[model samples]
Target: MVRDLDHALKHVSLRAPAPRFERPRPPRGVFTSQQGFMRALGVGAVLLVAVLPFMDASRYTMSIATSALIYVMLCMGLNVVVGYAGLLDLGYIAFFAVGAYISGIFTTVLGWPMWAALIATIVACVTAGIIIGAPTLRLRSDYLAIVTLGFGEIIRITANNLKITGGPSGIHGIPTWSFGPWSFDDGFNLFGIDFPERVVFYYFVAAVVIVVGVIGAGRLAKGRLGRAWKAVRDDEDAAEAMGINTYIAKISAYIIGAVWAGMAGQLMATHLSAISPNSFQFLYSALILMAVVLGGMGSTPGVIIGALFVSLAPELLRDFAEWRYLIFGVLLVVVMLFRPSGLWPATAVLPWLRRTRPTPPAFTEATAVPASVMESVDGTPTTDAHEGDRA
Candidate 1:
């Protein structure tokens, strides 16, 4: 029986159509290949122009750049929460307040080092994240936003009434960020560039911090946790059904966002040598959220663009200071109406977007057979024999 089956299979193999695979053809035209080298070249040129003049720019310009960079960092952090996790946090400024207060207390009253203060600021912000995110995240969407908004106001009010936080007077004379020997207050000489010239040191520090934050956010977006966050963002119910712990994922997003905001707070405190409840107002929170949304929520580059627009648009329109906010509001509304995806939408477009592998030629019964009949055992021509031989 085995030998007969093998003989039948051999016959079938001989008569069956050949199976083959074909390679895919390259796409023609309308292609947008990633050019990282060219992108890097353009970015390098822009940075050189923007930064090389820092040693000579006026104090006002340097201050503006520093503030803009800080905003960029904050937006990236918030992007993780809103953009990645799809959580709308309205009181993000609360974390910034926590960081500034922690840094202020550690540096001014406790007489600890600035680095130590920064570390403590992060810890405090993380603690704040848990304390706030725990009970509040239990609520869905709009309610969560309201709770966060209330929490932010609560933080600001507490800071206003607390003595350690300097009450309404706020904290003053907060020390500059420093390492073992390099005091940020004493700006270093970059080649011939003096650190303190027009407060260039702050810009230098801010640039480093922004770069680090951007890189970290990008890394997080591509890591395992990032995928989970995105899964939750896309569909919380589905993600939960798939065994992802939505609660933990949401909490992680808040903690990361809080830490980022805290760092920005530290930068703000050092830049102004002060901390105030006014600094963490609802307007600032809205502004940061604006940067994230206007840029491209989940996109790092988009968020950077949004931050620059939010920060520099007002500065550039200083000549029209009377209508600056009006113009800004108009521009934002225009952007949302026309290009709702964002200034740079995260959608990736390219030629031949669909899979383009060559398909095998299908053979039918008539096509598979030659224009001839097969003979039976008696040598009489037979269509049945030919049909059977067609396999």
Candidate 2:
């Protein structure tokens, strides 16, 4: 039986595509390596953020930009769960709320510094991550999603009912980060230009935070942990057979994602100076998930772009009036139809531009046993007689 099984497996080619049909790959525009593409993208994002303030922009414009940055962070965090680990979490916003409320309580109730609130939020989020992931990570697909959705709603409802969270009105007067007398709350003059202190400083802070988040997420996605996540995501049984602890990998992904979301929530709380149950509805969860899908899952650049689109499309299309959402729906449908793998998928890789045939081996190997050679009964060549003839 063992011999038969090994023989049967040996004949099965490992290189075949899945039984399910996959969409045709889109053409690679110009990128040859992942590193080059990401570097270009990072530089462009930094340049764009740097120049936005100088562009005669209004307060509304700055607000939109700030919101977009927050969305980018959220989407990237979710990417770890959905994109890398292949987990379908419907209520990821629960962690966001967890972070926000924890940080809010820390700052307002305990009168701690913003940095302390940030650290406490991360710790709480990690604890929450373990609690939520322990049992649900054992489930798969829709079963997992249902539990997450329930968890999300539970968090929201609990916040609404709790007095410490300020009931439905939520918590306010959450303080922003400050260093002694110099605070983000205080505006100032720079390079002969008087800027609105809160707007400029806050925007700068958000941008820096987001930039760091993007880099950190990208780095994690490229490391050993990421490989384990991908292995489990592709096939849990196979991953286990290969000695990978699928459960641990899944839980680690959840925890890391939780940490990212928690930090973002801290920023969100600080950015808005308030927290309400209304702010963490299922609608926001759905939107963030949509952004992950619409942007190529597991692709950092794609996720960022997707986040920006989801966050800004409503405001950008407000001029279209009642037809705005309809138009937006149509556009999303078009993108799905045309680029189902996403506008830029993570799996895109450049083929070798130059192909070369393998070099030939040196003398000892015989080609076709050579027409002139004579063999003895045991298949040893008659070279002994040939040696005397040559001498």
lDDT (CA) for every model shown? 0.80, 0.83
Clashing pairs in 2: 187-197
> Which lDDT tens digits does candidate 1 get at residues 99-152?
889999999999998888888988899999999999998787899999999999
What pairs collide in candidate 1? none
Best prediction by lDDT: 2
- For residue 302, give model 1's deviation from the true position in Å: 1.0
Global CA lDDT computed for model 2: 0.83
lDDT by residue (17-133, candidate 2, tens digit) is 233333444434336445566677678878888788788457787777787887888899999999999999999999999999999999999998888787899899999999999
lDDT of 2 at 104: 95
Q: Ten residues in a row with the worst lDDT in model 1?
A: 369-378
TM-score of each: 0.80, 0.80
